[model samples]
Target: MSTRTSETTVTFGHPFRLAAIGDAQPAGTYRVVVDEEEILGLSFLAYRRTATTLETPAIAVRGGPHAFHRVDPADLEAALEADGKAPRSV
Candidate 1:
């Protein structure tokens, strides 16, 4: 897997709890995608995900299953800078 390329679909058998987001994703099927790259035999995973289901909002992001590169931490600043946007304070 590339540092930002692993992807898959995952459905929650029960209500899934996301402590980071502080939201309990209801029991339902969802697409779980992980963006990470492999470097020197080490894998760096991203917390960001393209979680999707057959429903509202995130449909664009999580609607159809597709491949996308994960945004690596090292590249984030440079990318944002190139985009002419201020880096997020957080």
Candidate 2:
């Protein structure tokens, strides 16, 4: 099996909470990392998402080690939608 990773940033206009994170997070841009595995034995190449994570403390925060929390894609999308930001496809 083969895998690949992708990273992107998401901005929240208001504080939000993710079930996985267990706390309200401040409004800011956060780094989102996604891991996908390549599907084999197919006529067309494709990938399936294996995991998704959000960087805690926002990316702008400094002076501390950032923690990545595994988050559900739907939960993140709902959070973003509630924040008035369209969730970008990860």
Candidate 3:
């Protein structure tokens, strides 16, 4: 069994955190997410075990749930304008 001992909150550029946790000996990685209003989301990704004990895992922004080509800021702005939502501030 495992339990969370510590947690760090980040609220700057992105909205997520990477945490690595595991048994007392081994550790695993988990991506934690919080919404703009600060609500915990889902947890995923369980890779195979390694030889050495695992340490803290990594966390990152969701970066969207779909894959697509990168778009320039100007183009993204135009897209958002077309969609009627204001361009993102960050």
Highest TM-score among the candidates is held by which one?
2
Q: Residue 59 of model 3: what lDDT?
A: 34
CA lDDT of 36 in candidate 2? Answer: 98
Q: lDDT of each structure?
A: 0.38, 0.92, 0.28
Predicted candidate 3 versus true structure: per-residue lDDT over 1-90, tens digit per residue: 222222222122322222221112112222222112222343853332111111122234335352222223344334334445555521
Which candidate do you rate higher for TM-score, 2 or 3?
2
**lDDT by residue (tens digit), candidate 1, 3-79:** 45443443334544442323444555434344433444436543443322122112234555443333333343343
Q: What order do you get sorting by TM-score, best first?
A: 2, 1, 3
| Global lDDT of model 3 | 0.28
Error of 3 at 73 (Å): 1.0
Record all residue pairs in model 3 with backbone atoms less than 3 Å apart, i.e. clashing. Answer: 17-59, 18-58, 18-59, 19-57, 20-56, 20-57, 27-54
Per-model TM values vs. the true structure: 0.37, 0.95, 0.24
Model 3 Cα shift for residue 42 (angstroms) = 41
How close to the true structure is residue 5 of candidate 1, measured as C-alpha lDDT? 41
| Candidate ranking (lDDT, best to worst) | 2, 1, 3
